[model samples]
Target chain A: MLRREMNAPRDNIVEIRDLHFSRGARKIFDGLNVDIKRGQVTAIMGPSGTGKTTLLRLITRQLRPDHGTIVVDGVDIANLNKAELYKLRKRFGMLFQNGALLTDLSVFENVAFPLREHTNLSNRLIRHVVLTKLHAVGLRGAADMMPGELSGGMARRVALARAMATDPDILIYDEPFVGLDPISMGVIVRLVRRMNDALGISSILVSHDVDEISTVSDCSYLLSDGKVAASGSPDELNRASSELVRQFMHGMADGPVAFHFAAPDYAEQLLGRDSE
Target chain B: MPRELWITFVEFVRTFGALTLFLVELLIQVPRVFVRRFRLIVAQVYNAGSLSLVIIMVCGAFVGGVLALQGYANLTRFNAEDAVGIFAGFALIKELGPVITALLFAGRAGTALASEIGLMKATDQLSAMEMMAVDPIRRVVLPRFLGGVIAMPLLTAVFSMIGLLGAHMVGVMLLSIDVGAFWQQMQSTLDLRDVSEGILKSVVFGVIASLLAVWEGYNAIPTAEGVSRATTRTVVLTAIAVLITDFMITAWFLR
Candidate 1:
């Protein structure tokens, strides 16, 4: 019986402060902070390997930060115990990059899983609810299909149905629009907008596809070098003067992110000037 | 040298600690699984036990036949052909039944469990369960563990029964030994202690094999190659562990 507070001030559902995380010798996030506003689609845009997925994992408490607190639903997740962390996660649903459907189950059963596990619904009721969820994503006809039998877009839609099966208050989409045809991409965009508004749920979309993000996202954050390089509406982002933001938004080949790996100067190396 | 030793010691402690925690968590979830998801446990029993019956029966018959042949050959030279039943019965009930059943179970069901769970982890199904407020250990591992424990004794009993039948067939029908003497000797020589000991061994082997399989799968690297490696490790480690546990149980029983 989770209900969204639609009229509530668009306060932050998730907030990070002075976050620091590293892998081996490389630092990914340093003193990073971001806020996911309630009841809105917040698109996180970044170049490849800029900790966008890591940010989602951090919010879900799947990965811990080396420093700083991730406050989800007003509770500091870093301080929550195992039982508390799981309770916190129940409020959030995530659509993984690869769909991540349970391959052993059919489309119907995949969406029915969370309901069966968490609720006391009868089989008849479960079936009814599963069909309703699948219908939300225009996949009611595909309910009996197996994950492998579906196309990538179909699988993504089924995954979306499964993610929203429990009617979570927050939905996190990691590369939801990747690897889809134009029609499929459009369907997903419309569904994201429709579902967010219809269910009155907050959403966080992490994608590199700027056109789609600009079309669907209410507000967007461009992450660069472990911080928010730019934050604005899609129009504002497109019009921003930051070269890094512009390079990313325009999908330029040469900019802040080099086109080639660093190496010795070509002429000097070819001439073998110093032999050192 | 000191640093190397220190690192090794630290690694040992860490691994031991993790394993202890995993077992504790598994044990804690066992009752919850039985109470809430008894149907899952039943399904696993069918998967881990009933699916394994044909192989265990086939192996049991062959092993018994071979033992009868070898025992008859050796004992006939000493004019002790009548002792074939005693030899085969003792061997099957006391040792071969449990040990061979365990080895076969490890190769078949243990590897399958590992790969299945590993694939689930690789596909993020376990994480999905976690996000839905369900403990994967309770939903996935506990039933499998209990299923293995329950299946081991039943499979071992089947192996023993089939082996005894094979021995009787070989010793009485093929070898022209007296059927009455064969049955009578086996019945008298096989004690309750012997049967119970085999059951205990199979149960312990079941725990070791299933726990190791689930642990490997749960901790696998979540990749194709990682799942493959976890399956291989399940078989190899379960086999070695079964053998070691058999030795310890036997030594204790004998002492």
Candidate 2:
């Protein structure tokens, strides 16, 4: 089924090895391992509270794994100093769930931010690059608008432009289709595919929307209980034999995932036990 | 020991340690402001300084008038009514101006900075900056810190000037005390040392207030309620820190 590619070579851009992370007493990722191939669109899908976001944060070096190594490109990020980590970050771009545009900056300035911070480009050149990036997202006309003035979809598009402004080797999108209309979702899917092919950059998409995941991803991983329970092409995921996989993929109500919390019998809890 | 008291003591030590580390980080990033972030520093200065002029002026005028009126009443009993100017000048320049202006700045610009940074964190702007390889402390906090430090002494100076004018209006113009005595006594009592002392106090207070505000904001939990709590903490901690700092600086220099 190609579910576990343990023997994959070292050509992958990102590799996680036996990763373990926890929040206080709550374990999130346990002995998890994943590889992201270069110039491919990979998706991480899971039910609610399955640590999809945490995985992205670990890859970005925002949160260190409690017990393992995350290697980006070739360097083990856990050992990188602040300067080295920042230098490593330049090789990647990320789009947050809510777009995360700087509220004080206009759309144009937001797109120009990375260039202004990292490059010594002239103002004329910066303006040229910023407009070109915004134009790619079809938001050039809204360049002067403030983030508060943008619709959700527009803000997401602007964030996309800003993320790609640095022309990073890898792009990470956290919930790209979240809260989007169908048309907007379609636009994002097309853009992700088009940008991946045109820019020849790898992408890691974190989402639970099955349709969007299948449409945009070259490969997919389904995280369950702090582990990748199943991984394959989108079609293979739809035909996964595991009951947990079927429940999540098909959005079943009564399956391995309980509809209620684990508790004593409902009727006994509602009525006090008779005194013995 | 009471559990609450032990908890409070631990919290105090933790906060003190965190603040010390924050100040160290800020000092490390200070030079970057001049090299790459001059425009941001200028904007922060305008925000923290120019926007604060009116409040400082109005508060200074009222405080000076009250001082002059009370000093005259007390000195009248000693037959030293002409000493009103000296009293107002010494009190305003040596003690009241810097301390009161700091308190007001904490309430005004300090709170504003805290809320702004808190909102940015809640909205994931800080994370986005991190992803872009830009350090938020160097890009955001440094400008505000420098701005506060630059603005504090200037604001204190303005406050003292307006206060003296108010004192003059009360002592000389209204009470018909000899104008010559008023100016003469003020000039004789105040020196470059006293003015410098006041400036130094204000600059230190500025650093404390601005740093505390930004620290609270940056560490605030990313939520609406969390941002509100952080803003409240900025005002409370800034006020307390300013008063304590004023006392320490005053003891070291003024004495």
Candidate 3:
């Protein structure tokens, strides 16, 4: 979440240049360039199926782009091997869309996963760290419960706790507000800000909720047509000159963006035939 | 024709590279994966192994009853009903224990692993793991594999022993085959190879089931439909692999 520093700002932590990715024959991202600075929340927003998640995958090195480079913390993520990539990923934390907590594990184990995987901390220390993360996310009491027992909001918070368990340098949130109620959304958004401020972690939030994104992100980028079409502060996007960006931000239907529910002449032909 | 062949070869190489990369990733992070989820592994062992106990026992006992019934009827016709205990014990230890149990476990745990991981992949849990720097194969696949490998031999041994006991119960109390005679026949015919073959088959089946489940789960694509497909494939492939291994082991050992 966005947390402004009163003095000086940290340097950029993530940089991508001319990134292109293809899944089979489908081109998902092409010639995409962006920079995610440290100690700030950058929201990437787009419609569904516009490859918002794919872009995140590329940044995280889960899916390598067909062309171009992604550098995080002065290292090219693309050039790293599996082992090196695993090490690099230790710097990253992610809150998935569905709060992907392992169904078989308790909430305590879920939060402790990253710590146990990457560190040699004693069980006592691991417990302390896990409970601290849980407490940060306001779920310290639910540590022993199974994922299935938790509500949707609780599960997402557990996932957030697990994401931060290892004290990652970078945090990525994929649609944190998608399925939550207003209260839950408020809790998560607040926790994101609180955790970022408390831990000073860099974050990239991918969301479609413009209002929430506006409230939480210092900078926002609109991804469309396999590229970042517009990017700036929320005010910049709200008053952007680009027609497409304006249509998207204001949610206007009578713009260049079409629904494509029918072919150009299908509706007209159907109506004419019915009249005849 | 040459161009097509070249394309096919390149595709094969790419697939091989992906698999090799996955294996290398798994190998590197193995310790972390196991250490982190040791509790889950223990829980899975209890869930999978304990829940399957009654079925294993029932099948073993029922199979033993049938073996005794059939062996008594056939061998008595030739005035060699004394061989009933020997044949039943040898068959149970050599073939039924490993093969039947593997088939059962594949249907139970193998399918479950495939579907569970597949669903996780479908829902982006695998991606979540990646972002968290958690190794899915080591954390998820390896533990389930270990469970099957560890549980299979124990379950099979239990099955074989119980089956033999069931045979003995019927053979002595009802069939009137002398208990002393039965023990003598088994002592004379039973060898370590017979018992070892079943354990060996179980190990192979365990490896195959785990590999299949992990492979399918790793390659799972979008949609819960893909997970369903992986579950079916895991069961069928594991069962078939178990049968093939059983035949190979039986032939090598029996001969």
Candidate 4:
């Protein structure tokens, strides 16, 4: 019943409305709308360079939108001062694609990082909390090991442990499955689902692994050309008739989305007028 | 050419303004960092200070011996070989010590700080800290800045002391100058003013070197080439700034 009730209209943990963003002269998001429902794994699926990571940045107020409002739990992050923004960010646990564990610190200390910074927890308490989080990610045995020693998946798991140490209300994964071996991918996929339901917190995943996204996501949005090409249950997206959605879901080499970048005619460039 | 000159001038002003702002931000974060980040600062002192000790000492000894040998040869022309001690001491305390130590600091600790921070930025560790509600400026940058600034004056003092001994080794033991005359000349002529000048120069150089190191590292483009470039810039900028400031400080003291 609790999971079913997440489909209600007013349950969004983050709401983006009429979003507009750009990097220099190039547009990123144009009137994009997205909702991350409370207590569910919502995936933002897109082709590469569609600004999925940028969307995550905007959600956490790392970059301000050109025009539009992002409401994270009824607070418009556009106007938060530095102190206020940091306070708001305490609610989020973000796992970067490369894991981003502090190299100077060991696995345990890396997980203990946020706790040490934000809370005045005793050393014993911090250790307990760190080990607990590490255990949750199945990395308790690797607590004293340095980050450089961990495999990519293990490093990602350690990063996940670090991210969750502060008990954030929202867990964000930025391309979590990139370059992961299938076993590690399955482990991460299971953890993503388990963490969301087990903790009863929201998870916003930015990924393009359609199979993993379909398996783990409660709802998915496919983005193309600065807009949500389609959004619904993965099955619904799979069943959709739109060319962009079909091309992305099926991983077609060429479709409405051309493999070649937009440029001057290839023949014209080859047979240059300058040759005369 | 005019356009290029104008562009260079504009870039200079922009970097100057940015560096000033960065210095101010570190100052503002001072109380917060010092309050709880003392261990981090101490560790950085060990990193930027003790770790750089061997290089600093070796160079100081060699520089002192060279100065003494040269000063003795010059003084011998006028039968004033005793003043070799004064010459070496004056040069080491007032000019060479601070300038050379700062240069070495730039080469040793400065490169370390820049490359470490740059790599962290490349790996997104700094961004991760930011996302976790921890300010990297307070946690990472400020402590290192404090470490270098604290270490510089001390390192300069150590360098001058060790250089005097080096001068003694060459001038008194090897060159066979009258030991009493060499010792007396240095003790009397090398007044508090010379010591103060050395300390002042070192502190200033420390601030400049440390500030530049952290600035280049923090603003480095997050890539291997970028980090390498940041490290190179940290060394180059700090070396140039130390030399220019040495002349300026010496001139000011003379006036």
TM-score of each: 0.94, 0.95, 0.87, 0.96
Docking class of 1: medium
Q: What is the lDDT of residue B53 in candidate 1?
A: 94
| Stretch of 10 with least lDDT, candidate 3 chain A | A1-10
Q: Which candidate should be chosen as best, given DockQ against the real structure? A: 2
Off by over 4 Å in 2: A1-9, A261-276, B2-4
lDDT of 3 by residue, A1-276 (tens): 244452334388899899888889988888999999889888999877789988888888888899999988778887898889988988888888889888767999988877876789999999999998898778899998999999887899899889888888889998899888888788888877777788898889999898898888889999887889899999999999998888888887866567565354777677786456
lDDT of each: 0.89, 0.90, 0.82, 0.93
DockQ values per model: 0.64, 0.90, 0.66, 0.82
Of the native A-B interface contacts, what share survives in model 2? Answer: 0.88
Pairs that collide in candidate 3 are none
Every candidate's TM-score, chain A alone: 0.91, 0.92, 0.90, 0.92
* Candidate 3 CAPRI-style tier: medium
Residue B120 in model 3: lDDT: 77
Tens digits of lDDT, candidate 3, B1-255: 999999999996996578667656655655775687777678767766885688888889988888888889999999988898997898788888777877777777777777887887886677777777766776676777667667777888888888898888888778999888887989888887766777788777766766677677768775778878888888887787778877887788758
Candidate 1 has which clashing residue pairs, if any?
none
Candidate closer to the true structure by lDDT (higher is better), 3 or 4: 4
Alpha-carbon interface RMSD for all candidates, in angstroms: 1.3, 0.4, 1.3, 0.5
What does candidate 1's lDDT look like per residue over B25-106, in tens digits? 8888778788999998999999999778999999999898888888888999999888888889999988999999999998
